[model samples]
Target chain A: MAGGQERILRRRIKSVQATRKITKAMELIAASQIARSQARIAANRPYREGMQRIIREAASADPAAARKMLATPEKVDVAIVLVIVGDRGLSGPYNSSALRAGDRLVHMLQHQGTRVRLFTVGKKAPAFFRFRGLDVEQSFTGFADRPTFADARAVAAALAAPFVAGEVQQVLLVSTRFVSAGSQVVESEQLLPLVMPNDMEVAAPTGLKGYTEFEPEVEQLLTELAPRALESEIFSALLEGAASFHTSQQRAMAAATDNADELGQTLSRIMNRARQDSITTEIMEIVGGAEALRSGK
Target chain B: MASLRVEIVTPESALWTGDATGLMARSSEGQFTILPQHTATVGDVVPGVVRVATSSGEVAFCVHGGYFQVGPGEEPGVTRATVLAGIAERVGDIDVARASRAKETLEAQLASPGDLDDLSRAQLTGALARAELRLRAAQH
Candidate 1:
């Protein structure tokens, strides 16, 4: 019985060692990915700032022309929601958090007598919603890891089409916002008919702040600013999400590696003890057999 | 000084910051010109040539539609306009072979017509625009 137990312990030790090797490799990969994601986030900032400044300039030029572009429907009967999440699992609760928030928002909107239509942007969301007996308008996969501007534009047009033709009163986007290296929070933002937040435009940085004269008219310029504003917002969100995903994955991998190391240590101790016990048993059998031979003589 | 302080920016980096004699741009309404001490205005740009009438001569660039802001903060008389041009590239900036290869790939994809849905169509168009920008700008 003891020998059988010893054999099992030895086998467990080998398996644990193998697992440690995998976890350690994953940790390294995630660490490298974090740097790339952060670089992309940094590069996207100037474009985002430029887009916002232009939007402000346009809105200021002609609040009237902006009004034509920024028309808000009186009552929202139908609404489109874009839910962006991750494709794969294993990075804590990144996808689940978005999924739950999206569901809750949809429920709240429905309660307000507004019809909510849902579009998903990751692979994970489809099965999750389907399992819960919810209908998904569209779920696009394979783009979550590396989202291009075109991917953003595709999602944007879906939400915009309804609002543009009076199908949706409002369009909202739900995504994860990367606040810092150590933290990320899920955020739901308005995407269409940009609500011009006062005081932000005047707070411009690195902008040709002190100069610029409009040639034709102010209102005409703001018209161009609205769509560009939406595009910038989407672009920034994608960058943030990419950064946050890598950060979370890195932390998760580090933890996994540590756990694997601990398990390996425990298994090593068990394996050593098993070898010692098996050797003692072999010695006892040999000594017993010699004593029996002496008694027969 | 020709008032339009033309500033062109691409996604990768800023291209040019200089003065122009007169600026002609393609807007949503139509082609419009910006002159020194022009009134405050905003406009939507369509893809076309941006003609900068400079003191020495005129220089034109193949420009994609973006946002242009004139007299953002100035008090009307002093023309301080900033054009937040989008994806502006010198014809000489792009490598011909690379752009051509990209175009060929896109054309093949279009010809094969696999899921040439709205998404694919937009992707192809973007490829064509980029190639055209490179070819047109690099020629001169």
Candidate 2:
């Protein structure tokens, strides 16, 4: 019976080891992706900063025109919520955290008597939301791991249509912001009625403010610049989301590998003790048999 | 002494950046050139070739519709010119064969009798324009 128990333990240990191998491999792959995604984020910094600077310049030139676009709407009749998440699982809380935040935002908007429309970026989101009785208006898949500018452009175009058509007054985005390699947080922010960069974050104007000349005038330039700026924002968000996903997945897989190792150690210890007990029982029986033969003689 | 620093950047990466004598491109208003100590200007750059004149020679870039900003650099006597395009690449790096292929494909798509949404039609037209510009820039 003990031997049978030992056999079962051995089989379990082997299975654990096989799982460990998978987790270890996943950890290494995720680690490699982290560096690459970080590099992409670095590469995009120049364009993002440049776009922000141009926006600030245009906003300052004609405050009145900028106010119309930058000001938050007083009452939002219909709002679109966009959630960005990773397409794959095993990334720890990276996908769920953003999804939960988006869900909560929709609930809050609805509580205020505003209509809510949901849009998702990852394949993992639609199923999660649909199960909760929420209807997904649109879902874009297959690009969460590595997003291109064209992908961002498509997303922006879709989000902008409703806002431009006066059908939706507000657009909100929920995604993970890659603050640093060590830290990431899920945040929700307004995407439409463009949020103007605060004075603190924006670098001071090079020289005299309002001295910058606009080719087609500030009003026309701001109108044309809105969609492009949206694309830039969305692209940067996708990049950061990717980096955060890789980092989260690496941490999760490393933990899993450690857990597997501990489980294997505990099981082997139990198995070894079972073998010793069986050997002790056999030795006792042999001595008893020898004693009985001597007494009979 | 006054100097000019030019940076052509896209969403993916910075295409090029260096000290340059002048930057030339066409905007909605007209063609314009920025030299050292140029005034602060912010405007749109139509899809075309953006040329930068360095000491060695002129380098050309095929920039899709984008924006540019000319402003004072961090240091005094340095004017910084930045071009931010959604898509852009060095003219010399453009693959002429690929551009021509894309042009042909887009032309066929547009000419087909199949119904296309307004958004898709606009996107196809934009792609065709970009491919044609790339071909033209490579030729020059």
Q: Mind giving the per-residue lDDT tens digits that candidate 1 earns over A1-297?
A: 777887787788778778867867877876787787777777666566656666666555445676666656677788887788887776777888988998888888889898988898889998988888779998877877667765666666666666667677788888999898888999897777676545534644333344444534666455445556676677667767767777777787778878878887887787778778878988999999999999999
List the candidate 2 regions with Cα displacement exceeding 4 Å: A200-210
The per-model lDDT (C-alpha) reads 0.70, 0.93
Candidate 1 ranges with C-alpha deviation above 4 Å: A67-74, A197-224, A288-297, B1-7, B10-41, B49-62, B70-86, B98-130
Taking all chains together, the TM-score of candidate 1 against the true structure is 0.80
Interface RMSD of 1: 4.4
DockQ of each: 0.29, 0.84
Q: Evaluated with lDDT, which candidate comes out highest?
A: 2
Query: What's the true lDDT of residue A263 in model 1?
Result: 85
Per-model TM-score, in order, reads 0.80, 0.96
Write model 2 residue lDDT over A1-297, tens digit each, in one string. Answer: 988998999999999999999999999999999999999999999999999888888887777898777788999999999999999999899999999999999999999999999999998999999999999999999999999999999999999988888899999999999999999999999888888766623434433443788998999999999888889999999999999999999999999999999999999999999989888988888999999999999
